[model samples]
Target: MSSFSIRLYKDSDYEVVRGLFARGNLEHSHMAFRHAISVTRNWLFTLVMFLIPLCVTGSVILSILAVVIALSIIWICSRYVYSYYVDQCLSDDMLNIQKYYLQRDGYGFWVAESGGEVVGAVAAVPSSYSSEDKHTELKRLTVARSHRGKGIAKALCRTVIEFARNRGSDAVVLQTSLPQVDAWKLYEKMGFRKTLIIRESSLRYRIVDFVHFRYQYDLLANKLL
Candidate 1:
């Protein structure tokens, strides 16, 4: 296994880590789009609706043209909508890492380095949805594609979990989508349990229900036993 180190985030590492976050997420966008296409009934309905007109009119050329237009619209819209969250991460969190994480109490950002180069990152921040002080959120867990399966991601996750425990947190929670199969597996392997799942219901973005899974690791559960 390739050796790596996890350390606190520094201002100098901002740009590289930001790029990694964007690139890593874009890699998964293709899978998310594919899942949406496969599971969303709306896409099938749209195709059928457009085909019915061609069947009635017996105009093969118009039918093909209509199908092409419908597909174009679906593809374009799905890409844009799904990319919105990734864009938000860059705009809100990654770009303002210091203000959002380092500057706050009980919040931290970490980067994994291999051979003196940053290869992965993860963050633990106070959960806004939870009223308990012991609840922290794990976010932005990412690893470079070239360095994956070398325990880099697992190290980053452990860093966040250790950080949370050291700060007296009762639990560390995270959200991952269905497209991130590898990440979900890693979390489960690390003793994180699936606590809840959120499914998209909006009609406009229904093609990619954008399913989100919430996983949590209880820091005190083992100690209390």
Candidate 2:
């Protein structure tokens, strides 16, 4: 809907890209904290603890304290889970953009610019699990908060999908977390089907009720190639 263009990642975009990523990454913390508070284990613990104070002494102050403590615990767990993921991503391929996406064959990174400013970014790489089948994995699809809902995200996704198709990839696969509800919806709207659901094993992830959704867009099925 806005005037924008998608282009290959450039060296000068490094800091801006990472800054956008960090801010966008933190935006989901509220949802993560809410999810952690909703988990059966967490909620039950909080309920029981809060009730204990009321049942023992009928002290409103103590019950309030219990509730506060429970919320604090959930917040800490969610924060840890959120921070760890951002750190891992920033330290990994994102640390050396050129080496990870530009130099590698069948891999790419792109940024969407509007009014000469980067508003969105995405990358694709050969799927490690389905390389023999020529599958590509989409990663790091993000749009700046101020620029969302203007078709920037969709354009970035199409850029990766088309890049994969041109590379002879049979499908484009990607993983999203439960907190990224909008992201999975965009993938589905683009004809990507949910392929797998994984409950991460990390203690912090489990505490926050984090689940990963794997989606695949079959190029052959869509006759896109």
Candidate 3:
């Protein structure tokens, strides 16, 4: 890293950061997680081979149990660590998702910052994802888990709605997992209705006992929205 003094972000820096957030969160992260699991399994196999010769049948059973516990711990810890990186990447990409979803529409982004770093981000497109006529799409809305429950999401969602409203959008649309009860409430408070045409896997069917919903906010018709 360069020793250059800290300075405000430039356009080039923002692009670099955006690219880093995209590639980092998605392709690289999944690949790295897979590689880590593979490598850890190989190492576990090697260690098991080394320890097998020194153990009796009962000892072997106990040793296997211990290894299973240790491996489970390692897996959980690794997943937690991965979530840190994933949050950063997802937050960054959420900003771009506004652009990607909007396509031709202007990408308006709302961010919450802390200590000179972004802690939350939300983005929106001027068009709806629903088959229904005339609705805006809330593209990617993400906040670091540490930064939740502080009205950050409310601000972000509201900002996008206003921006889309200005762009002549009639409604705001989105998809979210059922596990996020808080998010559902936020949408409801913002006048977003639970729609039925959502195409995401988690929404269309139970993805491992998970429930999902397609949410929409009518910009013109609903006063609460």
Q: Give the Cα-based TM-score of candidate 2 against the true structure.
A: 0.94
In model 1, where is the ten-residue run with the lowest total lDDT? 73-82
The residue ranges of model 2 lying beyond 4 angstroms of the native Cα positions read 131-133
Clashes of 3: 1
Q: Judged by TM-score, which candidate is best?
A: 2
Q: Write the per-residue lDDT of candidate 2 for residues 59-120, one digit (tens) a residue.
A: 98899899899888788877777677789999998999988899988889999999999988
Q: What ranking emerges by TM-score with the best candidate at the front? A: 2, 1, 3
lDDT by residue for model 3 over 138-204, one digit each (tens)?
Answer: 7546555555676767777877777777877777888765434567788988788887643334311
TM-scores for every candidate against the unseen true structure: 0.89, 0.94, 0.53
Give per-residue lDDT, candidate 2, residue 103. 95
TM-score of 1: 0.89
Clashing pairs in 2: none
**Candidate 1 lDDT over residue span 92-161, tens digit each:** 8777898888998888999999999999999988976468888889999889999999988988888887
